[model samples]
Target: MVFTAKEFLQLRETLQIAVVKCSERCLYQSTKWAAELLNSLPPLSVADIASSQNTPGTYVHPAFAPNNDPIEAALEAKELGQYLLAKSFFDCKEFDRCAAVFLPESLLAGLLAPPNDASSPVPGDKGKATASSSSHEVTLPVLSQKSLFLALYAKVISGEKRKDEESEMIMGPQDLGTITNKQLLVVSRFLKRWFDERGSGAGESSASQGFLEYLYGMVLAKEKNDEEALSYLKESVQLFPWNWGAWLEMTNLISRVEQLNIVTPKLPQNIMSFIFHAHTAVNLYQQGQDLAMSINDLISVFPTSSFILTCKALLNYHSKDLMAAEQDFSNILALHPHRLDALDHYSNILYVLNLRPKLAFLAHLCSSIDKFRPESCVVIGNYYSLLSSHEKAVQYFRRALTLDRSCLSAWTLMGHEYVELKNTHAAIESYRRAVDVNRRDYRAWYGLGQTYEVLEMHAYALWYYKKAAGLRPWDGKMWQAVGSCLQKMGRDRDGIKALKRALLADSYYDTSASSFGSTGPVDRMTQMDPEVLLQIASMYDRLEEEDEAKAYMELCVAQEDGGAANAEAGVGGGGGTILGDSVAIHADSPGAGSDGEAGEGAERAVGNEGTGVTVATSKARMWLAKYSMRMEDYETATRLATELCQDGVEVEEAKALIREARSRMEPVNMMES
Candidate 1:
């Protein structure tokens, strides 16, 4: 088939789409096809077209008419062909070959030639670009901005790959961590030299400068020079807003919402800017209505985009709507089964829901598709974590980090696994690394708080918990941690205030009337967290605030009643028994009956497998008994204590309270007699 220039350009677009859809699968084949297509097209130069016009009976086609610059068309065709070939090599992981396609032979020869040698003039010298260097300049082909950027990027990747391979050969494929600055310095030096040669001449286009800036920014980012990287990336995006890679680099530099807000306005006002903002918002965990609006706008523009769908799924995930997030991810995968961007999050949902078989299937599928991918590793890690193989989970999480050092989920998940293994120090280190990568990740801050709390460092734990709470103000777990830490630090009033905030945050209360036309608000408060009420009541009791303590105790009792009613109505199962509760039991903790003290009665009660209602009722009665005794209401105290003894929870304490109440009542009875 004789392919015209326009036809070849169209084929290049098709191949690009195929590359993105299939990733590495078709890269080599596409590259070979592009090469063959390029070879089949007749080589036409300006000199040839000019010489053909002077030849006898030479026919010049209308496509190469005088109105059109045939040389420009020829150059365009050559640039596109080179770009397609280089991109294919890049996608196929032949970084050196990709770079060689763009780097001028003159520049490469100049680097190898001795500086003092008069044979090869320096490629970028301004004065040397006179008539004396015209021959060398003609030999160098003009490269497009994107082609140059890709070449530099390929060099960076090539350097990293070379270093990693060497390390792997020595260390036998263990986790080698992030690439060192020493390895990237080689690419950095070449980039600096290229820019120095280009200068601020009119010959350099704005697009060219933008690509160069983006490449330099990427190098600086990998070297951990955030300030410089941010400056370069910001400039690059402003100069060329369509480059998604530059926008992504900018996103990585922003670690906080404040920084994101500050940087957002500086971006160019265009569709890419909007997309960048939406992407950054998701990364920063800003799942507010504004983020939703931004996502909706992008979806309207690109309805079938898997990236937008992934963002939507992440928003739902952060909103605690696991089922909605799961469905969104499922839809995305159904449309684009080969996509590997957010499979880790889907695996997380499965792990939380305890869908062991499905998680296993996902892990196996991801491994089969590409085991080296970070998302696949994370999926496998979550599967191991679900199976209680925490050490294996950590190993895979570590491997994921090795693949992508800035993988936020791997660091945070590894910290969780470390915590499970009781490796507090290792967990702290992992959490700190995660925080260093992205301060907006509340999970890392929360993990840090939990680690410190386990170590009994209440002050440190409280600070970290507060940091997490500040980031995710609506997350009740963060507030609850803050409250617990404050209580441990003996700040009872502050602890109560924090606990109340947690209660408000956690409860999904419906103030509107029920569908059945109830006159009052429907008491549809899911996750009311009876433990928060108990904790607040205990604090109030310690403060000698009888009314407040009694109020919270009554609320706990009402909560249990509501739960029991739901169970009887078949709305949900009655909360599990104390022994079946997932929370660990401490002997000295309130409502935890001591086996040694209660003896055979506690054992029999535990064997009965009482519902959550029974546990809540027992706790409420125990507290009420103590409160009544404190108020000198001997009859009420005796009645409440007797009820606890019958329930068999805290049996020894209930019996002791009954004995004290009876002794006090006996004196009063003597007066009556």
Candidate 2:
């Protein structure tokens, strides 16, 4: 059936509205309707319209021959019809659909189609005007910029190579060489011309501008010109700050430069402000601020956001509020069970809470969902490690490595397993591989240091420990190791300084509250080897810092709990351990061993007359007796002195202290009190 000019005009408008819905079924119906309309319309030329005018063809129709522009009309109709039919099958979410319809080869071929009827211009060509026209005319608009952009986006989404498993490399620069060389060159030329024509308007184009920049940046980064690519990404974020894709691309670009220690241009102030606030709460939490309180305020502001709740849950986990963290994580799981990050962290909470069966089940579920994912394998491996199934843990870690050679956590955890089995050589190799894969990982550095310390290579251990401490200055454990290492090397003053820094860092990280809702004692020296505590005490003594010496010695005695040999021996059953990886070893010099022996002798008179005396308790009493004598509490000193004499250890020093205390002649009740 032939259509009147007005009918075709009305039909095209109706089809345009349908195409805007952008659904597969909607486009299919629109395409079918367009095809029927195209079939009914005559292929009218300017010559035919003009001839009709001369014939006074019953008042030449306005819609069919409005402009006497046959080429424009033909190109517009052709572009609309082709775009509708092709786009109907270009489902962005379906890889197969995109691959079949909008492949790079297919798209490039369409771009290279010969000039239609010689009246249409190629992509960049502004066709020459006729002899009757004064100005040059072009059909460049027939290139269908929107269709080209959508197809490019689809190709990028479909063809980009994601990592086999997550790693730092997942955020590393991509290799966008999926298309052939000829296709790449042609596509590059077309994009360059497209940019030149509309570049001025790009920044204001919002979503389109950001996406275009992201694509260009990806191409440049693939080719390894990071500086230029970074520039494009920076522009992308600046132009479209709300576009998550552009922001993620910018983050990847920044990570690429930062990993290489390459200097990047300063981001614009607006973008920096945007980025700063995103991470501010996390940084504050790491610095030991109350994240739950801060996050509660944020939750009030954005009550519906799962991300804020997730952050709060993670902060609670770090702060050791296990119950609160479990609840928050459970809430998120109920809402979004497929969130992998939440699942991984929630599984960790289960493990920490000693819900081993639940942890194993969750890990099994994660692996069943995607066994090839390195993270899933690593999670299962971690559960086995916690169970002391070193052999089983090693198998899973190896599996993770097979899936992703760049899995940094797997290498580090493998080292920890070797350490657990007391295989120093294998542990060292594993830790070295971990550091090789990721130089910035403090855990790997700490692992290497621990192995060296185990081998008694003090200098190597000191170097690696310092590296770990430098990477994570907030971690008191590394500083504690550094202090112990320096003391081993006979650098008493430096050791003292490092130990004090460790104490300060430990305090800074103590965010947990007591039952009374007050901050508890921040000193966490229980993790230190009792021998290290003794050495620190000795250092204070040599420095003539009596009060400091007494304080550290008291902590040492409390840690030892009357079992001096346990202090001398390496920590058994992982007493110094946190999270199964760390092994606590107190570095002891030959001189320190003799000092410990002397301390043991002084500890002989530990208990009351009827009570059994232990070496550590006697040492504590001896130190307390000396402290009392120094303070000139004669009565208490004389009592302690008599006890020491009866016990027959440190008798000479006790007698001397008693004599000195007695010379002060203090009242008995006042001195005792």
Candidate 3:
């Protein structure tokens, strides 16, 4: 086995190649061969190997270099063996083993390797690590810069793995928190050292530098230093414009920062096209452009991107294209079953579609993977609530609150569950917590109002309803609640104003039948709508203007008849009145007939409800009878009261009025005699 120096170098290079190309099992099998190959090699420095002169039929061994430490050769062999083993483990996803074997060896190799004089200053602050020239030089039997980075990466991943495993353990919260904190601290120190490693020096490409920055950004993100993390991640993309990994990292950081209303870093013009296209499409959707078109254009460029497809599907769901959105989401799930975004989005779609079985499956699957994610917990809670399992729903909702107390929707939903369970006090507390979490949450404010209204706290209910109205002025139901609360509080003028606003916002707005249990028999089921009209009429009547009251009563009659007609015809007017138009009927004036529309309009105003006109006649006749009696017009009063008795409403009152009018008429007749 006598060999030239070049032959020895070639043999070592061949063994290094074998180590890289073999699998873990193959490497183990070849371990003895590698050891023998290394042991048979002469103690020759690279310079000695290069300087050796070729001699015919003989090996050339040059003079030893001064810096050639014999121990360095052994250390190199040990470092190479460890690096290969760790790499194999890493490739197999055995992070713990990789970290255990590689990190120490990589560190020791750097310390033992002689520093290079030709290398530049280490990057970042002064006193950061500097790499020797041989650090990343991928020669035989030496740890390269790639190996060092991998070792650090494995260590960080191992820490994360421990944290994840411990989180799933049934340990005390305090103990789990302590252990997780220590693991994070260990990872943070390693990341700092990885960043400080000057050995992965200027010779590395800008893309590699970007990778380092990305890793540092990830550490900063874990520490909740989002601003610095964003800065480093942005720097990474700027340094390596071609790296998709960097782009994905930037997208994740931007999404999180934007959720907190934090300003994102400005992207450079040289940004990657796929990210730019996707970002632009989403931005256009936010700006109220045609979301479908934007998403279509994005998909045209990136047809296979699940992220883009998911975005398009979400946009479709929002736009009410449920079937199309469902199909797209299904496609994404089929392609990537574990995609969190797709799972989250499709869960909502399933809920909306009332596909309860699928929703349950999605909730269970998502919870299995993301047990502590508040949104996933909330989804599970909603599934239980749908099943009328308020008790189970509360458990999941409470778990969501524990995970993130600031999840306002969870609090609001918990309030809904409490309300369903008739736990008014708990409901109130949950709503209050929700509002405290986000003052702009009108749902919480409305919930509080509803709860107070139910509790007969009119003043408190009014205050909360007003707050809700201010937050969501266009919500006609809130305005209606405000009106009802005001009316309960005897604020007639304000009540009328709120009621009118409610009508203007939503003409069909009606108070819930269940809300007025204690106050009045009037509710949506029992024509609560007509009650609103009557309330306005009474407010005017209280001002001693009987004519206006009579007019409103007529309008109420017209609305009732229209609703009946719609129902009989099987035409859904959705509880809206089909009064031809807003025709002002003045007090003390006979109702005139409007002719030739879809139906006859008040054809014979005095008593014909069948034509949508006579519905008002019964109330009108009653009011006219009262007015005539008050004016001493006895005959008119008697006749009108008699007609009122024929109608089904106010029969006993009409009979009494008739008796009184006739008795008074007898006196008048005697006077005439």
Strongest candidate by TM-score:
1
Q: For model 3, where is the 10-residue window of minimal lDDT? A: 585-594
- Per-residue alpha-carbon lDDT of candidate 2 for residues 538-583, written as tens digits (9 for 90 to 100): 7778788887787666555454333333233333222331111012
Q: Kindly provide the TM-score of model 3 when superposed on the true structure, using C-alpha atoms.
A: 0.44
Taking all chains together, each candidate's TM-score versus the true structure is 0.70, 0.54, 0.44
Instruction: List the candidate 1 regions with Cα displacement exceeding 4 Å.
Output: 1-92, 97-144, 166-179, 186-199, 202-209, 507-527, 562-611, 614-620, 662-673
Please identify which of the two predictions, 1 or 2, would achieve the higher lDDT against the true structure: 1
How many residue pairs in model 1 have overlapping backbones?
Answer: 0
lDDT of each: 0.66, 0.54, 0.56
* Best first by lDDT, ranked: 1, 3, 2
Is 1 or 2 the stronger prediction by TM-score? 1
CA displacement after TM-score superposition, residue 183 of candidate 3 (Å): 4.2
Candidate 3 residue-wise lDDT at 82: 76
